[model samples]
Structure formats: C-alpha cells, structure tokens
Target chain A: MKLTFPHLGNAYIAVKALLDELGVDYIIPPFNNKKALEIGIKNSPEFACLPLKINIGNIIQAYREGADTVLITGGCGPCRFGYYCEMEREILQDAGYDIGFITIDAPRGISLKEYFSQLLKITNGINIYKIAKAVKNTTEIAILVDQLEKLTFKMRSIEACRGDTDSVYRDFQQEIRLINGAQSIKKYISQTSQKLTNIRCNTGIKPLKVGIVGEIYTTIDSYTSFNLDARLGNMGVEVDRSVTVSNWVVEHMLKKVFHLPRDLKYAEAAKPYLGAMIGGHAQETIGNSIMYSQKGYDGIVQIYPLTCMPEIVAQSILPAVENDYGIPVLTLIIDEMTGEAGYLTRLEAFVDLLNKRREMAASDR
Target chain B: MRTGGQPIEALRKGMEYLAGQLGNIEIRGAGTTGSGRQLASVIIGADIVKNEITAHAVAAQNLVPEVKTILEIGGQDSKIIILKNGVVYDFAMNTVCAAGTGSFLDRQASRLNIPIEEFGSYALRSDSPVRIAGRCAVFAESDMIHKQQMGHRVDDIVRGLCQALVRNYLNNLAKGKLIAEPILFQGGVAANVGITAAFEEALGKKVIIPEYYDVMGAYGAALIAKRKMEKSIDTNFKGFDACLRDYSARSRECSGCSNVCEVIELFSNDELLASWGDRCGKWSSRLEGRPLVAR
Candidate 1:
C-alpha cells in the first residue's frame, strides 16, 4: 500500500526515515505552497481552519500522484486539530477516494491493543519487531532533528560569521533528506556539530533572547511563521523555541509507554494567568511565556493561525500575563493574506524593543 | 489606491504630503503599520515597524488616555484592541471576512445610489430599520437586495446595512470580550454616522470618534515613530526630501534552489537600498553594509 501524509515541519523527515526503514512504500507529498493552499481552499468549507485545508490539499495532491493509504496523527483534545483527521477522512470519502487510513495518537478510551492494531495495519505483514526497530530509529531521528534545530537557534545568534548556521543547516537539511541508515545520520550530525564548534562566535556580545510559543503545527511549519526563529537568529537574537516535533512525540506519543514525568513546569508557570489547558498549546504558551520571563528572556512572541480557537483564548490571557510578568508579548496571527513585509517589520521592531530593553537593563546594572 | 509603476515613488509622494501637512514638526525615526508596513519601512527608513494591533493600541493610548477598548474598522479589515492602563491587554483583527469593514459599507452605498458620506445620515432618517442578514458579505448583499425589492425605504435599507455591519463586527471580532465603555471608534468607517448610530443603539452606549478617524492608522504610525525616536540614539528619518526623490522597486526570481523564491530589491538611483524576500538570505545580506543613503 502506498502511504501519504501531510507535512508539518521536519516531522515528515522522520516519517520518511520510518517508512523507508520499514520497507513500506510511501509517497511524501510536495512541500506546502500557494498551489497546495489554493487547492485546499477550493475543496474546503468556507470557515475551516488553515491547517485542515492544507492537509486536505496535500492529500488530494498526493492522491493524484498515486497514493491510496493515508497516515495521520490523531488527538482527542479540545483543539479543532484533534478532530481534523476524522473530518479529512469524511471529506476524502465524499470526494470518492477509497483510501486506507492509519491513525497514531495517544490512546483515549481505547487500550494500547487497539492503538497497536491501527498502527500495525500499515506494516503489511512485516515482522512487528522490525517495525518496532524502525519506530525507534524514527524517534531517534526526530530527537536529533530537534536537537540540530535548537543548536542552530543558539549558534546562529552568536556566530561571528554571518549565514554560517544557515549554510550548515541548508547542507544538513539536504543531507538528511538523502542520507539513509541510522549510523550515517548520527555521523553527519556529529560532523555538523564539530563544524559549528569550529565557526567563529562573538564571545562578549550577549544577544537579546526571546521565547517562541504558539500553536504546534504553525509553530513547527516554517512557511506558516515565515521562518520566524531563523529570522530572529539572523537578527542576532538567541531564540528559545518551546515547541518541537520531538517534544510533541514525547508528550503526545511516547509518554504513555514510558510513563514519563509530566512536565508541569509550564503548567505551574501559567497558573496565575491560565488555570488549565484551553487546548492547542494555550496553556503552554502562557506557561512558557511566564517561564521565559522568569528565566530573564528579553521578550516572547506568540505565533498562531488566524481565528485559532485555543490561541484566541491565550491571546486574551496574555496581556494580564505581560502585566503581571512585566514582559512584552507580541501576538502574530498567521493567515494566508499575511504580507511578509509587515510580518518582518513587526519582528524587527519587536527585536529593537527587546534590544533596547536589554541595553537599558545592562545600564541600570 | 493609485496604481503606479514605482511603489517607492508613491510612498515618497505620500511622505512628502505628510511632511507638508505637518509643517515644522521634525519627522524623527519614522514608523509604519497596516498591511504594507515592510514596503513603507524600507522606503522611509522606519525606526520601528510594528503590527497594526500594537500601533492602533499605542495611538489610542496617545489620543485618549482613558480608552479601554478600540474599535477600528478600516477599508478592508476591522480590529478590536482591548487595553488597560495604556497597555495592549488583548486584540483581534478580522479574519477572511470583510463583512464589518468599510468595503461592505462602500459597496452597499454604491448599490443604493447614495454617496457614502450621506449613507450614515440616511440611516438616521429611517423610521424603521429592516433586518438584513449580516453573517457573510454575500448573504448580506442578497438579503439587502431582497429587502429593496420588497419596497423597503432606501433610508431603512441603509440603516439596516449599518446595523448589519455593527452586528457582524460584534459577533466576529468583539465576541466573548467585555467591550468596555470609553471605546474609541477610529478608521475609514468611523466617518459613517449610520454605523456610529447603529453601534450606539446596539450597545446602548456612546462610541467616541477620534478627530482624525480615517487616518488613525497613519496617526498611530506617527506616534510610534515619535515614541521610538524619543528613546533611540539616532533618528533615521531619512529627511523629508526622500519623499520627493525617485526610487524604484524591482523583483527577480532567484532560481538558485528548487524553491525559486522571488527576491525583491529596492533601488534608489540604481544603488540598492534593501533587498529581501529571499529564502536563502543571499540578496538581503547585500543590504547589511549600506548606509542610510535616502537622507
């Protein structure tokens, strides 16, 4: 069965690794672009959220390119995103596309047995142990990819040589897409780290630090936020991106199996502002913003989709958080009509404010 | 709204006009907001280009110190900014729907053969306002036409349109929020007496219209520019002369990678001012070493 799934940042890269390693035939849809959005919009409901439409577009495009089986991550949460998979399935079925679907998500009411059964459907009679190995590899890759991204965030700001992180990152991106096998991937990461270490860095100039927290899909997807973290990094700002694909994997996927200690740090931090999860990382956004302020980060930028339900709740609460914390929070609501120029201007201005804030603090000291 | 071969020149003319109007006020550390903020910033050498949300909030704080909420309905978009103690508390702009913005009012006005200036006054003349569906632009239009065909008075129809806009605005952007009093209504649409009346009637509260309502975005931008300059070491205003100067903006598709990102570059006298929109950061870096040549 040919497999296809919508892209959300570098999660697809790990998925690609998993499918390839599992001897599963898969067709990863083309990167999201204007055509994908246009197609998605044409086929979607008038008021459907952006990510859902994009996913539908991706699936339709993939279907046209000869893919039947669809693999989607599911969640039963307060957020609209959790219900997207079922919606997409219904829409696709209405469009006369008979397709097999595999959904992997945290078991809600269903036991691990039902969850594995759904997961194992795509294995196509392959050895379950081998599939498990592939899962481990994918997990490792996801972690590594997240690590590399974090390193880039920290290093890019401090690098004396401009665009050094970008070039290395670009090279690494190309390498990751092409490179097969776990050992080779690890080797490449180590070599890239060594390369990063070798690059000249500013020892004395402390860059302004900012924390990014927002809707998971938009935060993860570069095109959605127009590569916000990288842009901040280029402007010589140390970025602390709270949400990552690996974090999603750990919190959403593996936590059940591992019985991992619940990361209540953000929950505790956001307590004064927000009491509980309003869904779609709203709690995290508040908690992380508080955490960042306490950690002495210069500012926090919250990025989310336009009319995003959960983020809207968070946006309302942010002003109080800002007041209580005495920190600036810039809320950028992403939509298709968002002009890049305005977005960049806002970023530049926010950074300028942060830099001035930092400079003033230093002088006061 | 004037289409031009040179957007930079258009921006220059706009700046020149603003400079002329302001007289001896030293334009220091210019700032831009609204949709085309980046392009305006590039041309004007803006000190800080903030989003319309922050800009409008800042402007409201500057204009009316007691303003708790701001209802700004521009030509294409409407936004609600909630503030507390001169700080942006929470804000939301219209998304995907232009129902409550001036465009809807403008279209309805034109359709009714009434000048937009008189549209609001006509609404005030109506004895009984019809209920027009204000859910979406398309539905509202069809509903208005149906009401008109049913021999509803033009005044009532106009009044209905205003009420529809107010309903749409409240239902969409201002939903679930406590739209506190001392709300300043500013934007292109604030000129409409009909909308103001409808808003007042609907809320049973008075909405204050700022003196320069239509150009409040511009006003907010100026305030931001001034505020930013006050704290900054250098005012990169680029002089008022840049407004009259000739500059050109051009775009070239960079086929360097598979992405084919179209990199746009602004040039003044054939010298590159700024080049961005490159995914690879190849052209934008060329702008790094340049001085503020616009001055």
Candidate 2:
C-alpha cells in the first residue's frame, strides 16, 4: 500500500528515513504552497484552524500522486488536533476520494494490539529486529536534522556575508531530496553543519536575542509561521525556537515510552503562570516565554493560527509575563488571510523597538 | 494627500505642492513611510524607508515626549502603539481586516451624501446615539442602513457610526494592553472630531490630536531623515526635480515556479528602476545595483 503523510517541519526527513528502512512505498507531497493552501481552504470547515486546512491540502495533493492511504499522528488533548485525523478521513471520504488512514498516536493512548496492527501495516512483514533498528536510525536522523537547523540559525545571525548561511542551507535541502537512507541523511547533515561552522562570523557583535514560542504545529512548520525563524535570522537577530520536531518526538512521544528523564526546567519556569497543561502547548508557550526572559532574551515572539484556543489562552497571559519580566513580547496571529506586508511591518517594528530599548538602556548605564 | 485611485499622480501633485510651499529650500535628507513607502522611496529617492508603526510612534514621541499611547487610523489601516520610557513597548495593527478606518468612514459619509469633513459635526449634535455592529465593515454598513430605515436621526446615526468604528478599533487592536495616557491620536482619521469624542467616551480619557495629525507619518519620516543625515556622508534625496519626472508601477506574475509571486516593477520615465514582490529574489535581485526599496 502506498502511504502519504503531512509535512511537519523537518519531521518529514525522519519519516522518509523510517519508511525507506521499512521498505514501504511512500510519496512525499509537494512542499506547502499556494495551491495546497487553496485546496485546504476549499475543502476544510470554515472554522477549522490553518494547520488542519493545510493538512487536508497535503493529503489531497498526495492522493493525486497515486497514494491511496494517508499516514498521520494522533493525540489526546483539549486542542482540536486530537480530532483532526478522524475529521479529515470523513471530510475526504465525503469528497469521494475513498482514502484510507493510518493514525499513529502514543502507544499509551491506544491498545497495544491496535498499535502493533497499525505499525505492521506500514512495516510490511519486516521483523521486529529490523523495525527496532529502523526506529533507532529514524530518531537519530531527526535529532541530526534539528541539530543542523540550530547551527544554521546561529550561523545566519553572525555570518559576515549576508545569505551565506542560507545558501548552504538551501543547497543542503536540495541535495537531501535525492538521498534515501538515514545514514546518508545523517552524514549530509554533519557535512552541512561543518560548513555552517566554517562560515566567517563577526563574533564581537552581540546580536539581539529573540525567542520564538507558540503552538507546536505553527512554530515548527516554517510555512505556517511564514518562515519566521529564517526571517529574524536574516535580520541578524539571534533566534531560539522553543520547539523542534526532534524535541517534540523526544519530549512528548518517546519520553513516556522509553521512561526517559524529563526536562522540567521550562515547566518549573511556567509554574507561576500556568500550572497545568491546558492542551496544545499552551503551558509550553508560557514556560518557554519565562525561560527565554530569564535567559535575557531581548524579546519574545508568539505565533499561532487564528482561532487556536490554546494559543489564545497563552496570548492573554503573555502580557503578565512581559510586565513581570520587563521584556517585550510580540504576538502575531496568522491565517490564510494574513497579509505579507502587514506581517513584515510588525516584525520590522518589533526589531526597531528592541533596538531602541537596548540603546536607551546602554545610554542610561 | 490621498492616492485617490492614482498613486503616481497623487505623489507627483503632493511633492510639487510641497516644493511650491517651500521654494529654494535645499533638502539635506529624505525618507518615506506608510504602505506605499517602497513606491514613494523609488519616486523621490528616499534615503530611508520605514514602516508606519515606527513612523507614527516616532512622530508621537517627538510631539509629546511623555506620550504613552498612540492611536493611528489611516485610510485603510489602523494601529495602537503603547510606549514606555520613550520607546515602543508594544504595538498591534489591524489584521486581515479594515473594518474601521478612514476609508470606511469616507465611504459611509459619501453613501449618506454628507461631506466627509462635516460628518463629525453631525455626531456632536446628537445626544442619543444608536448602537451599530462594528465587527465587520459589511455588517456595519447593513446595520447602519437598518438604523436609517428605523427612523433614526441622521445626527445620531453619524454618532453611532463613529462609536462603532472606535469600538471595533479598540476591540481588535487594543486587546489586553494597557493604553496609558497621555495618549496621542494622529492620522488622517484623527481629523474626525466624532471619532475623537467617541475615543474619549469609550476610554474615559481625553485624546490629544497633534497639530499636524494628517501628515504625522511624513513628519516622522522627516525626523528620521534628519537623524540619519547627521551621521551619513551623503543624502539620497534626488531633490524636488525628481518629483517632476514621470513615474509608473507595473506588476506581472512570475511563472518560474509554483509560487507564482507577483513581482512589481517601478519605472522612472521609461527606465526600469527596480522590481520587487518576488518570494525568491530572482526578479528583485536582478536590479541589485540600483537603490532597491528595502521593506
């Protein structure tokens, strides 16, 4: 059976490695584009969030490429994401595509028998030993890709020549499309990171540090966030993203299964503001905001789709965080209707504000 | 100075008028702000191009050094900027909606066959104002019509419209922020006394309108230009004579990729000055040698 999955930042790279190792046939849909967004808006419910709409577009795009079954992740939360896979299956079925769905939630969320059955469907008669090896390789690939991206983020801020870091990163993305297995992908990532490290940087310059914290889907997916991390990095601001695909996999998916140690620092930071996990990274948003402020970030940017309940809650509470920490926080609510001009204006204005604040403080000193 | 359906023509006339008013003046530096800043900078050779939020905040700070909040409503956009210690602490702009701005007010005034300038006086004449929906422009228009049909007084309807716009602006842009005083209201819409009164009534505080409210963005651009000129070796100002030159803008969809970015090209006389709006810099970067507009 041919399989297809929605894009989630660099998670696709790991998924590709896993499916390849499993010896399963799969198709990666075109990168998030205007057509995907258009199809998503046309097919999705009027009130649904942007990520779900985009996922619809991705699945439909893949269906056109001869994929009959769709692969997606599931969750149990107050956020609407927990219902996405079920809703999408019905939506697509009503639209008359007759697409099959394979949802992979946390094993704890589903019965062991059901989880293994879903896994076997994708594994295609692979032995348990092979499956375990594939999972290990896939996890390593995810971590390596995220590490490479973090290096790119840092290099972009300090590179002596503008676009130097971007050029290398872009070339790596283009080259990765042809490489197949996890080992090759891991090797390519190391080479790219080395190139990023070799780039000449003006180390003396203390760039303004900005932390990006928000909904997991929007924050991780560059398309949804309008390439926010890259945009800030290009503007010479040091960017620290609160979430990454690998981080999510480790913290949410693997930590419980493997009984790994949890990093409660962000949670402890968030305790004063949000004690409980309401759903969909709301606690993480507050926790990361407080963490960034304590780390002396110049500013924090919160990005989320319009009508996202969890982020809406987080947005309201951010002002309190800003006041107590004396750090400026910019909340950008985006959707299909978000204008590029207005978004750019807000980002530029935020940067200018941070610069002026720094200058004033320096003068006062 | 309004674009009035023809930005190039309006810019030409505006610059020529300014030149006539200040004849024989040597321009040391120049900058452009507002939505059409890129186009304006290309036409007049601006040394710096800034966004409206920064422009508005700077101008407000220049006028009232202790100002804490700035309420700006231009033709198609509105913004709320909160300042602390002479620095922009926070700000929000109207997102994907233009429900309550000067253009909407202008359209409503014309629909009522009232002079736009006199629309506010009618608001002041009414004591009992009707409530109108202000969530969306279309809804507000239909609601206004329903009020008019119900025999509401024109003065009261006008006052209701002002209050509706103010409510929409506050609900949309000023959410969860402390709008501390002294608040400065500046923009084309600040000329509307009705909006000013509504703002005061809603916030329970007096709103101060700057003397040059209509041109505050330009004023801030000038202030920025002055500061830039102090440290710069030379100015990019092409002088008032550049305003006399023919300028035109054209847009074409690039089919190089699936993105289909609509690249805009600005021209001076018949020469291709610069092109932008491409997601991939292939089209815009072609004119890298020229003084490209930096948004």
Candidate 3:
C-alpha cells in the first residue's frame, strides 16, 4: 500500500526512512513548482493558501501517475490546518479520483496501545520491532545527512567568497553521499567532519552578515523564494539562519504541547512582544528579527507569500522594531511570476551597500 | 499573555541575547519558503526563493532516509502527503473552511462562555455526543444552540462538535486517497486532544504526533537552510544586528493603466529598495535597484 503524508518541515525525511524500512511502496510528488501550483490553483478554491494549492496539485499528479492511497496527518488547533484532510477528500472526490484515503491522528497524551493497534491494521502484523529499528536508523541517517549537507553548503559560501566554490561543492556532495552510508550517526558525523576539514578555501576579509526572517515556509524553502540563498552566497556574502525543522518540533511541538521550558529562551522571551496570538509563526519570526538586529547583524531580510495575513500583521509592526533596533530590514513578497533578474539585482545592491558600510566601519575602527 | 510596553521591550532584549549567542556565521546565500516567502526573501535579501513543498520535501528527505506518509496541519491549512521510497507521490490540502480548526473551537468557546483552555478536558468527559452539523461553522453554531436547547449536556455537545469536524475534514480533504499506518501528525492543531480523539475514532487508527508540531514549518525551513548553509562557501546573512533598521513601505495608485494597481515601494532609511504591484512593471521598473530601470 502506498502511504503518504502532507509536506511539512522535516516530515518527508522521517516518513521516507520508515516506509523504506517497512518495505511499503509509495510515491512522493515532485517539489513544489509552477506545475504543482498550476494544478493546485486549477483544482483548489481560489482563496486557498499557496501551500494548500500546491499540495492538491501534488495529489493530482500522484493520482495521474497511478497511485491509489493517500495518507494524511490529523490535527486539532486554532489554525485551519486541522480540517484539511476532509476538504481535500471532498475536492478529490468531486474531481472523480477514486483512491483510498486514510488519516493518522497523532495522539496528544493518550496511550500508545490504541495507536499500535491501528498500526497493526495497516501493517498486517509486520514486526513492530523491525519498524522501530527502521525508524531509529532513518532518524539517525536523516540527522547526519542533514548536518553534513548544511556544513558542505556553509563551506561552499566560505570557499566561494574567495573563489573555487563550484569545484569544491561538486566534490563535497559526492564525498558526503558516501559518508551518509555509514552505519552509525557517530561514524557519519566523523566522516563528514573529516571531509569538510580537508577542503580548503581562501576566506575573504570579513563580509557583512545578514539575518533572514519571515514565515517559516517562505523563509527556508528555496523553490518558493526563488533560490535566494544561492543568489546571496554567489554575491560573496555570509548569511545566518535561525529556523530548523528539528528544533521547531523539539522545542515548540514537544515543549509547548508538554508545557516544558523551551531550549531557546528567545521564544519564551518574545512571547509577550507578539501580544495576542495572531496564529502561525509570525510572532516567532518577528521576535527572531528583533533578536537578530539587537545582536548587531549587518541587515535582515523578511520574506512572505503574497497576502499571508499573519505576515501582514508582522510587516505592519516591523517598522517600529526596525526603528527601535536601528537595523536595515528588507521585505520581499513572492508569487509565481516573481522575476529572477529583478530579485538578484536588488540583492546585489543590498550586499554592495552592506559591504561598503562594513569597509567604512573598519576604516573608522 | 504579557502585553504592552515592557513586554515587547523585554522580548526584544531576550532576542538580542539569543542572537549574541549565535555568533558571526557569515551567510553565503539564503533561500525563502512557505506562504509568506516573498516578504521574507525581500526582508532578508534572499538570493533564492522556493516553495514550501520542495523545501519541506527536501528537508524531510534529509531527515528521514526512507519515508512513506507525511501528515501536516498548520494554523491556516491542513495537508496529507504520501511518499514512496524517497519521492513525494501524493498530497491533499484544506484551506476553505475553519470548521475543524482550532480557531473554530476558540470562537465557539467564547460564544458559549467557555474557556478555550478547558475545551479538550471537557470533551473527554462527554458520555454521549450530541449531533451538531459540522459541515460549516455557522451551521454548527446554530445546531449546537438547538442541541443545547433540546437539553443536551455540554460535554456531549462538545464531543459531537469534535466528531462533526472530524467527519467534515475526512470527507473533504482525504476523499479519494489510500492512507497507510505510521502516519506523522504535525502542525499546531495536533495539540488538541478532542480533535485527536475524534480523528482516532474516525480512522480507527493511531497517529504519531511528531515532537515539534507547532513550529514544524519553521523547523523544516531551518533544516533546509542548514543544508544550504553547509554546502555553501559563503553566506548571504547580513548578521543579527542588521535587522534593527527602519524599513518602510508606501503604496500609491498607478494611473498608467485601467488596472490602477496599488504599487508598493519598499524603503530602508529613505532609500527605495524595491517596488512591486504594477502589472506591466510600470512602478516596479522605476525602483532604484530594479533591472527594468537600469535597462
């Protein structure tokens, strides 16, 4: 049976590993792109969020490819996310796509007995212990792969700033993939670390640094943001990011749900700045921006999808934060047709200005 | 629940402290994703922009070696993803109604003079669920009132509301797809016990709620960033302190065409950085860094 879950931060990695272990046949839709958006927009309600449309588009593509079952996540919250499964089912039915629809509602504080029983229904009595082992292996692999990839990318910028980044990255990806096959997380980490240390690059005189902020999806997904990270790196500048899937799940999902102290104090500290909960992660985004600015970053960039409500609220209030902190903040609104050249030019200019400012500061010092 | 002057300032200070700890990790390049990516890219001077699907999928693949299904629910929407091996195969989303969402419950709670915090606990105590139309928020409300008038207990009514929402959700979003076990339920809504119970009852299955439900989107984005960051030789990050500058936007009606598009111009300390909104690039072309102007 093909099982699937809606796309989220790091869910694909976790689920993919488990499925592989279970030996279940499944298919993942292509990354969100114009085609996904096109199908989604054509099928979805006009006022739906971009993510929803993309997801619908993904299902359409999957069904067209002969996939039968669609797996869904279950939720209950003040946000509109909890009800997506029902709506999507209707849309697909109306569209005449016949397929199996299942939803796995994660238990909040309930016992695992019920959940395990449910699993048996789908797994047909597959070894739970085997499943557990697969999950463990997948998690370890995922973390290791993620960390290595991040380090390699970081090293690329550092190398590229001084030149020869293209060659370095080419070799790095190959080496890291080999290391990813390691049997343990420690082995993977050490192998990857050794690989990174061997790479050499000329470090440029300190370049200006910038912090990125905004809605979670928009800030981190390159397809949505038009590969802005690569563009920035190509411009010979350094960047710092504060969001991650593991941290979000571990800190917010686990901690907030369980009512535990958050590892990142800023989340707790920024709670009050957000005032009434506007829903989504707008509060955290704004809080991070404020935090980044105060810490003396060169600049900050805020990105959001067109017409996102919470982000609009954050945008409306960011001026006050910017003024209070005295940092340059640039906000970008993206849609399907957002031009690449236009985006790049603006970034190039921003970096130039920042670079000049840094030089002036150095001279003054 | 903190509010007003002191809280905001205190939060800012706390953020600063965190920023200080992050140190000077020069960003080579940055990318933006999710619903609000546009504004995020512009604000952070992103060199690349991507959609949440690609970003999330990439992140998930990086995190999990082999995956099967992904369940994602967030503040404004919900979705189901099916993955076979390592590729995304199928997915669905719900965006129109708020009937099964947390905000709907919150609204219902205030309307019924019940504290939202106690909603789930109350639902658990329900002996028999009252029938409430969960097809739409307005219908559910009227139906709930009618049920109350008919002498239905509050707990039963609440439980019924939860079930109705679950039915509506399944009927609408997951209509024609096959679902499998080992499902990961994520996003902010996963926190609700009543809804969780309702889903379990509907599916007759157990769902795994990931450790980070509320901030999964951000975390996913961050994970992607981490990958991108690691591969790069330099970073485009402008440093933490750079965020504390005056950024402003102003909109004006473009009279160049019948569209009369409201052109928005972004500024940082009196300098125009970017402009958008004109359909034909009328206003956008005139902006300082825009290529149309340079051409």
Q: lDDT per residue, candidate 1, B44-99, as tens digits? A: 77787667766676677788898998999988788887765555555666765789
Chain B TM-scores, listed for every candidate in order, come to: 0.87, 0.94, 0.79
Candidate 3's displacement at residue B76, Å, is 34
Model 2 misses residue A255 by how many Å? Answer: 1.8
Count steric clashes of candidate 1: 1
Q: Report the lDDT tens digits of candidate 3 across residue range A57-111.
A: 8788877776787776545541344466777888888988786676544424223
Give residue A220's error in model 2 in angstroms: 1.5
The runs of at least 3 residues in candidate 3 whose Cα sits more than 4 Å from the true structure, single-residue gaps closed, are: A6-11, A77-79, A104-122, A127-135, A160-197, A252-261, B1-295
DockQ of each: 0.14, 0.50, 0.01
Candidate number that wins on TM-score, 1 or 3: 1
Candidate whose DockQ is highest:
2
User: What is the fnat of model 1 with respect to the true interface contacts?
Assistant: 0.06
lDDT string for model 2 (B1-295, tens) is 6688887788888888989999898888999998888888878888889988999888989989999999999998999999988899999999856888999999999989999999999999999999999899999999999999999999999999999999999999998889899999998999999999999999999899999999999999889989989996588788887878877889998775445678999887789988878754555655445222222
TM-score of chain A of each: 0.94, 0.97, 0.80
Candidate 2: clashing pairs of residues: none
TM for every model, in the order presented, reads: 0.77, 0.95, 0.50
